[model samples]
Target: MPEFKQFLLADTAEGLTEAEILSVRVQPGDEVTVNQVVCEVETAKAAVELPIPWAGKVTEILVEPGQTVEVGAPILTVDVDPAGGASVNGSAPAAEEEMKPLVGYGSKTVTTKRRARREVTPEAPVTKGGYVPLAKPPVRKLAKELGVDLRALATSVDGVITREDVQRAAAPAAPTAPAAAPVSSGARERRVPIKGVRKATAQAMVSSAFTAPHVTEFLTVDVTPMMELREKLKKHPSFAGVKLTPLAFAAKAVCLAVKRTPDVNASWDEAAGEIVYKDYVHLGIAAATPRGLVVPKIRDADAMSLAELAAALEQLTTTAREGKTPPADMLGGTITITNVGVFGVDTGTPIINPGESAILAFGAIKDMPWVVDGQLAVRKVLQLALSFDHRLVDGQQGSQFLADVGAILADPAMAITY
Candidate 1:
């Protein structure tokens, strides 16, 4: 007789009610060790890896990938004493005292790893014109962008193509013809199942747009001084290893501007009939990931120096792009910034993120002719737009806040006075 133990989904973090099973790493009869990740799940905020607590052979998997399960639900069962001779009730004496706690269950450190996927049958080899390559979607997209034909690469590693293979193939590449357009002949309408992050984002956006009265204000400024400062900072010892960009300056400006206009860092509490003003700022940076838009916050952003802010932004964006941002980092945001300029587009009216009163949109920076005193010269210029909850932030406050941000960007020295 073997003692079976059930592994329930523990509360991974605060405010997480349920998660969608992204992948199942183990199956029945597989031997697993304690703390080994058994599956991955995606919550409304971030994707998380769940580790099994008991070491044993898997007896059964209760949940499948893509199915949402609530916290405390039994996800899998394991036989602790697979060699037999255990209590009939499946209780191993002293099991509780011998088990080690799983890391990151309630801590800031997050563990994320995927087990090696089971190999699939090798597809047919490539001919000249009709060969399909073995690669993930992102790897294929990279190959297409780099003008490397995946069919040309030799599949020596488990008959699968990887990102490194695509990069190596593109290393000594010459100019190649544009990729042929994808040909399709069928009904144009396609129905995409809206679930996971996409579904949550759609619902939040709809609610915010309808519930909050939005007001947008725009300002155009000469950012020549800010650009010059960035170039100088890059060579400075204190700023070494920091990838400072216009966004950093914009972030710092928002922090300082919020001090002057606290309403921008507030939330409208209609049910309570009170406006909640946040004394501290958890600055949110909106990142467009493969899944959808995710805004991960930098905690206590107003207290950080320029270098610290830059590093925080870099880490936040990287985590988001890799689809590993923890759900805790996506909550409690006081205000947000969206850089549409990265895509080479000018500013647009951005909607306020739910729970936050204001959002800023940074537009493309361009060199254009401008009047300096009485002389015309080409200068770095930027367009900025701020959207706010009109109920909390009136037109006057919105204008002042946007103007202050523009002023700081136009002249970095003004930040000291602010």
Candidate 2:
């Protein structure tokens, strides 16, 4: 005898209500170990890998990739030895009474789905010859989502209708050659469903744009000294293997400038009727990934040395681009920096993140003619744009913060005195 058990989808991160299935790592009949990654899911915050708690034969995969599931919903099922295999993961598996029911499933008779060959219900209409479509619950759900009628295909492919059957049936009708003239080939338009990180980022941007009263200020600075120092540091023995990028320098400058003008590191609490000023700076560096735009933070950036900030920046950007940034790393950011310069763009008014008071857009650095003490010379120049919430930061504070950052970048020596 074999005991069947279901492993429900738990919230991977705090406050996560739903997640989209990125991929399924195991198939039916596959042996799995405890704490092994069973699947990957993308929540609003970040992409996360979910591990299975049970070590047994995977009996079923209840969800398909591209499907979004609510927390506590059944995701997978496994079969364990019935005689005494209850302690698959050490202590006796969590009792059925301990599992929390899926949200919105109140008082509904919960039942596990069985193999399609088991039985057909009366509600399921039978075809002309009493042939009821045999498909698992997950396949049926997929068919419904794609607007495919399983009954119409009752001339059943084989025995049980599978995921591929539903997909093949749902595909658009092939373009036929016209009798009068040959029809043109290929689809000109492409449509992609917006459901994952892109969808979440859109909603967040909309909310931030409407909720926060934004004011953007721009400042152009001569960074000849900064660029010169970068070259000198690269040759130094201490900076071996360090990525001393302009973005890293900008991040360090932002952290230092925050100490002189703390308003940029504060947030407005409408409900609490107060301004929340943070003593420690959690600097967020916006990185664009293949999935979408994500801002991963460097904690207590103000306390980190320049070398440490550069190392953290390199690691953070690499992880983010690989889509492995943890959900927790993307939260609780006090201030943000978007390096538009990476794309060779000058500058733009960037939108502030929801919980943060301000965001700085670092532009591309290039050679420009400048008046240095009544002398015209070619200097490395870059533009900086700071967008802040008007309710939390005023014009004077924002200008001061921008000026302080520019001063440090123009002359690294100023950082020592500050």
Candidate 3:
């Protein structure tokens, strides 16, 4: 008789409660070796591939994709040899030393392999042009933005509708903008489920907004000197192979400014009825990805050089935008910066991340008339907005912190004073 071994879903990292089953890679009776990836899951963090620790034949797949299951729950069951000799399909049992630890090693060596994707079928036919066309999430979002009805081109395409089709469909009139989603005649609304990163972000924002008394301050600065210095640094041999960005300069500035106004780097300890202050800075850069907005931190950012900061920022944001930022990377942020300027916006109030007292919003850089030595002339100007927890940081402290950041950006030399 074959003995059965139930494979339980383990917590991939700290504070993991549960995860959504993203996909199952094996079917019942499929032979698997030790450490063979069996499924993929999406936690509040990132997508993780789970590998079976035991070599056996997959007896049952207990859960389906998109279902949320708690940690320690059985995700699948495998049949093993009763005597623990040869395993599934007569393969020798894996050596004990070669097996990955089951508890927290859920994602280690979890290779990325493309599983044949399931066909996406439209759910309803109540739209203006009939049932929605078959397309991936990104393609759908693109079509909606371009105003090209999916149903209109559904018949023209053989299978899934590509982004090119939508762009081509909308080229006649709104050539620049692809138009989709004819909502005039059909259902007035659709709902997106709040889960994963989106769900976690909603909860955090609400909690932070309600618990922290937020105070935001704004400043405008001429960044011509900073921009000029940046160009000079780009040509320097030491800065080569580094991706220098304005955000990096802002990060370096924030670190320098924190030395003077440490209150912005502190967090409120409500449970302890005291304030927690730190000498070191774990600077978080707010990133926008397909999943949602995530702020991953640069550990000990205060100690890094400008070049190091720039390289770290490049790696951090790229990982985030790819939706591969690990759960551990997203935790323990001391302060955050959101570069809204990349989207060409002037400035807006930003919310502070949880556990941190302050968040900075860096706005677009533009040429504006400025008074230089009492003469109005065109200069590169940038806007800054700083939001802080009023309960922890007083108005004066917040303003000073914002001023310190702006001063460094306006004149990089000002950082030396801080």
Candidate 4:
């Protein structure tokens, strides 16, 4: 007979006092292996899938889905054997319980009061230190979104933790008390509950805003030719059902512009005291969804054809809006582009996405007076704003990238020249 091993949910990061078990993919008596995704736990940032630390037989699932549990809490129990063979007496090593692998935050055996009133009756809810667990407002908000009940949690006896508990709190919530209802209504701002990826984005944005010195530059370009080319392309048989807009051209121009200017395709590495330039392009498209603003990058956008890029963009936007974007797809971008023009706006000083060097904002393309053939003529024009890290890219390099993009939009024929 082989000695048993028990697996646990190890702490992934700090400041995570409690977690909401979003889903349990594995059940008791199920055979599991190392690196197998057993469950997904929702922290304040995003829901992360936790892999089984070591291989074993899942003896019991200690937690339920949608249950809020503190960090270091027991999530599951697994039975394991040393070398897959012997009992503790023979080939198995000494029972060093604390030396268990992935038995999360280390294991502790506790003796609980056995049920005596169990003549076919439900047992009382478990409480910690003779008091029900209590969480603060923000924690409560997170638990609510994760479908957790604070009253069902187990906390220390002294319920000293209140709404004013500052440490370990990250979620931002605007109070919706009845007295403040009038002001909220007057602003007409929809109070979207912050959770999931949106909450993570909020934290990143705040950190970036305060950490980085954001500088934005704006330019106006005549994109009449680009718009015309889009119309012409749509008439082609292959482009049927594909909405060809100036954005597709803009994205292509950005890719070309990046080749000319590598610094724009770089990131500021503060700790390393260097600017890291990427050889490839992970172009991000900033899309506005009902959930929030999500920038789903089309990996290796430089290699994709016009048709492929358009299709990719369409799919990315659709998935983002439906909140079906996978965690892997949301990261690793070199640069970003936002189409503010769709909302009928004309240019804005957009903020750079965190970790990336630059972000381009495309304004509405409208008919305006322009100098075509050195004469004042009415032509379709668009404004472009390039926001870059000054530390990484100087004005000269930034201006050149913007100019290249503008030139492409000014005359789609220039795309052939390049």
Candidate 5:
């Protein structure tokens, strides 16, 4: 007789209430091993893979893809003793007195309760007047919008209908109109659900903007020397295989500037009624991802060499773009930098990220006419804007920090003197 066991979705981190199932890897009757990835789920912070605890043949999957499930909900069931063939005698093996723990089981103690099974009939089509098909609410809405009858469409999986099924049914109707037809004629407005990383970012921005009093200061500097230095570093052996951008130099400048103005590297603790100053710098780089804007931190960025900082930035952006950044990496940031230059835009007043006192915006560098040594010449000019929390940082400190950053860019050699 085969023994059956159930697996629940454990909370991956504290304060995580739920996660949406992105993909299901295993199905009924498929054998799996312990610690094998069973599915992928997306929380508010990031997407994570869930593994099964017991090695067995899958008996049933309770949750479908695109469905949001709460923590501690049963996701699937498996038969631990598949070779016993318990179905031949129409009887299941007796429940074990003690069960092994799974990866997602957490530290909580497990309790078992048995209940009699009840038989369920298959859902009938709308014409037969039995019941509607098993489709999620969002999928049902999409099917209605596309004029697709859920019961009339064929599904690859048993017992459930999916969004893909509706899309396939609707694809045949698209060619009725001309390919060049305007989309606005069909649907004037499209709505997207705000959740996951986007939702968290929105809430954080709102909180930060309202709670903190922001003061922005802008500075324009000639960065011709900085650009020339980058060209020289390209030929250096230590910079081989590293893509050195102006952001790397700006990051180093900020790290050094913080030492002169340590208040910028502190956070205001509202609950404790205190301002916390950090000794080590956990620098944050704001990267725009397909999902949304995410700030992943570089641990001890102040101590890293130029080459090391470039490498860390490369890995951080790659992980963020792939939506694989973990929640732990997104916390405990001391300062941040947003490179608006990548979008070819000038500086703007950026809101401080929650828990951080200051943020710097690096603007696009352009070649323009400037007076150098009382003579007109074309030089690389760039703009920098610094936004700080008025509660912790004053005008004098903010201006000095921005000035130091500008001086470093104006002359890369000033980094050594400062």
Candidate 6:
């Protein structure tokens, strides 16, 4: 008698929650082993490669790419045996099922037929006359960027074309004037439909901004010493190829400040009748991805060095830009920092991400006139804004915490004393 084991789904670093299948890597009859790469999944955070735990021949892929799947749902099936050879045709060996963990370990045998899916109308329809009219999501987004029209593509489908079809069609017609205006907007204004990260962010921001009484405080600091230290460190062989920004130093400063001011590292629990101050810091870095703004937290960021923090920030930004950040990395954040300086913008009074008590916004660094040692001179200066909930923190405490962070960034050497 042959035995079987099902490899249940574990957390994919950047997979979706409702299980949308993006792509499948293996097929039936393929022999696989434990820890072998099974598939690549696209989640809210980043694209993650999933590993198969049990070794066996591939039986069937239950889901297809582009379809979302729920957690704990059966993703794949495999056969296991005492002799190391299991077949799907063999009877259910009771011994194997008995050994399976009851909860959260492996896949459970769900007895239900798959549901039929509804038909989806393509945005661009393939019409007769040799014109294939259709656009994928990326193409649609590109068209919005380039100001192309799906209706125009449909009316003038010259050949079997895709999103690449629409792009090629609009590329040569560049009149260099007003032809690139968005079709969705007025002749002067354009409107792009909200979807993906932008859509999710809009919904979340609306909920947070409307629900919370947001209060933001700003502080302009002379970070000349910090900037000088960063320039010196950039020349070091260890800091090669890393994009060293003042924001990195700012992140470290925030972490150090949180160590002394634990109240700022907390969440509001309305149901529990308490403001929970966390002993551990899950430092959230707000990243602006193509999808929208996402806050992926670095677990125990307080324990990492400046180099480690730089690497983590690099990983987070890259994963975020690629739309592969894991859902787990987005959770459990007590405080957040958003660097709007990348866009060359000054400080913004940002709204706090719900559940987190405070969020700091870092603005662009620019040369400005300042008084140094009672003399007016040009120096590199930057602004920092801290938005917090007055319900959890008072103005005095918030001011002091912001001051401490500014003091650290103003003199990177002070971090050693603090």
- lDDT at residue 264 of model 1 (Cα atoms): 97
lDDT at 232 for candidate 4?
Answer: 87
Q: Of the pair 2 and 6, which is ahead by TM-score?
A: 2
lDDT tens string, model 5, 1-418? 6787767776676456568899999988788998999999988778889888888888888899889886556677778888878432233323433344448546554533322322223453345564456766546755765688776765544445666777797786544655675556346777777777887788678768878899999999999999999999989999999988999999999998998999999999865789999998999999998878989899999999888888888889899999999877888899999999989988999989988999999999999899999999999999999999999999999999999999999998988876
331-403: candidate 6 lDDT, tens digit per residue: 7898999999888888999888877878999999999999999999988899999998788888887888899
- Model 3: residue 195 alpha-carbon error in angstroms: 1.0
lDDT of 4 by residue, 1-418 (tens): 4555444445454345556788999876577787788888865433567777677666667799878775545677666653455422333222344434343433544222122221111255644555345554445544543445455443332342333232223346767865733454346656745564566668557656765678788899888778878888999988888877678888889888888899989998764778898999999888877656778789999997787788888888888776556555667889999999999999898888878989999999898998878899999988899998888889999999999989888887777666
Error of 3 at 108 (Å): 17
Give per-model TM-scores. 0.75, 0.76, 0.75, 0.63, 0.76, 0.67
Cα-based RMSD of candidate 3: 14.7
Give the Å shift of residue 243 in candidate 4: 3.7
Q: Per-residue lDDT for 317-404 in model 2, tens only?
A: 9999999998878889999999999999999999999889999999999999999999999999999999999997999999999999
User: Which has the better TM-score: candidate 3, or candidate 5?
Assistant: 5
lDDT value, residue 26 of candidate 1: 95
List model 3 lDDT by residue over 1-418, tens digit each: 5656677777777667678999999998688887898999888878778777888687677899989886656787677663554344433222221223354565453211222333333553345755455675546655765677777664333465765677788787644666776755448767677788887788678668877899899999999999999999999998999989888899999999999999999998864789999999999999999988888889999999999999999999999998888888888999999999999999999988988999999999999999999999999999999999999899999999898888899899987787
Which residues of candidate 1, in runs, are more than 4 Å off?
83-187
Off by over 4 Å in 5: 1-3, 81-186
For residue 408, what is the lDDT in candidate 1?
92
Q: What is the lDDT, from 0 to 100, of the residue 302 in candidate 3?
A: 97
Could you tell me the lDDT of residue 304 within candidate 6?
83
Q: How many backbone clashes can be found in candidate 1?
A: 0
For candidate 3, the per-residue lDDT at 332 reads 94
Task: Give per-residue lDDT, candidate 3, residue 101.
Answer: 37
